[model samples]
Target: MVERLRYPGGLRLLLTPNRSLSWRGNVRIWLLLALVSGIIAGGWALAGVWFILPFAGLELMGVAAGIYVTSRNCQRKEVVTIEGDTIHIESGLNRKEHDWILPVRNTRLESFPPNTPFDCHRVRLANRQQQIPLGDFLNNADTDALVHALKARGINILQTEQQPTVGIWF
Candidate 1:
């Protein structure tokens, strides 16, 4: 999910990963799968293949573990707010939150292409002293839209002639 709000003097951007399965939906699917597996395993157990029941239980446990891990990060979000001469960024994943504050006049926005074709591109805000990445879960289109929105707000984006070139080494 990508949402952008433009105000008279600033902009707010929200980015979240798209989740195909909700927690409730996951539980329903898991229960259905367990029931089917149990019925099959019970039939085999009745036929004297008792080991099949334990193996099915093990498989169900593995599936449950995967679902639990995935649900932990499903609520992750990246929030960006640009007001006056300041930019604020807040991000959270798995209940851990991080924040960054940058002066609009001194900060520069930099975008890096994904390392591989399958990876999502990254955007960062940096100054002479520090740099912080944003939008780790955003897809290419959302990242691009974010950059465009920032530029529209008169924010200095790296590589633009309006801002001095800063070495990428930082």
Candidate 2:
């Protein structure tokens, strides 16, 4: 998901992975699954296989953990701001994990042409001093949209016809 906002000082782009289910919706689905599983486990326990109950509980705990992780990942947000001559990038779930502030004139957008027809382009924000990745969590379509938005905003995007086969970007 992309939200573009205009402020007095600059433009801000809020990027998030496309969400089909809200946090509450996820919880509701989990609850339904848990209730059904719990009932089945209770029935098994009552049939004298009591040990199955503990295993069922453990399985539910593991599933809950997985749900929690997914929820946190889905809640992540990446904020990119362009103000005057500076560009700022902040990424994290609820707090900033990556904070990059660079001069807009020196910074350029670099993307690897998809390595395969099914691959999504890997994008990076780079300057003489540092190269930082952007939109690692976005889908292929969203990534393309991000590249287009950057291009429209007059940010330089490096295009190399050769697809990188083996490389490390720092």
Candidate 3:
């Protein structure tokens, strides 16, 4: 999801991934699975199959961890603020954040075409020193929206046929 807010200085783009399930829904799913598995496993354990109990506990723990990670990822966000002659970007998952500042004139955006297998469109923000990926967590439609929003804000976007890969020098 791309939210465009026009601040006093310039534009602010708030980017988030599209979530099909709500927090409550995710929790409900985990709870349902855990309850069902626990009942079946406990019944089997009572019938002399003691090994099923430990396996069921492990399965429950794994499911809980997976749901937790997914929830944390859903909380992730990237904020891009274009003010005056510079653009500021703050992005991270959870509490750890990274900041980047680039002069408006030096900054540019590139749109890479989707691959034959994945069908994921990539948008990247770059300057002389670094290139930061934008909307990498979003879907194709959301990425399209992000590109359009940046373009509407006077940022030039370049289309690319292939994704650029960097190779380390020996």
Clashing pairs in 2: none
- Report how far residue 21 has shifted in candidate 1, in Å: 1.9
Poorest stretch of ten by lDDT in candidate 1: 161-170
lDDT of 1 at 36: 98
Residue-level lDDT of model 2, residues 17-129, one tens digit each, is 87888889988988998899899999999999889888888898898898889888888899999888898999998999879899988889998777766567678999999
Candidate 3 residue pairs in clash (backbone atoms < 3 Å): none
Query: Residue by residue across 80-99, what tens digits does model 1's lDDT show?
Result: 89998899888887543888
The lDDT for every candidate, in the order shown, is 0.83, 0.85, 0.86
Residue 28, model 1: lDDT of 95
Worst 10 residues of 2 by lDDT: 161-170
Candidate with more favorable, higher lDDT: 1 or 2: 2
TM-score of 3: 0.87
Per-residue lDDT value at 29 in model 3: 95
Model 3, C-alpha of 59: deviation from truth (Å): 0.9
Off by over 4 Å in 1: 5-9, 94-96, 159-170
- Give the per-residue Cα lDDT of candidate 3 at 92: 88
Q: Which of candidates 1 and 2 is the stronger one according to TM-score? A: 2
Question: What order do you get sorting by TM-score, best first?
Answer: 2, 3, 1
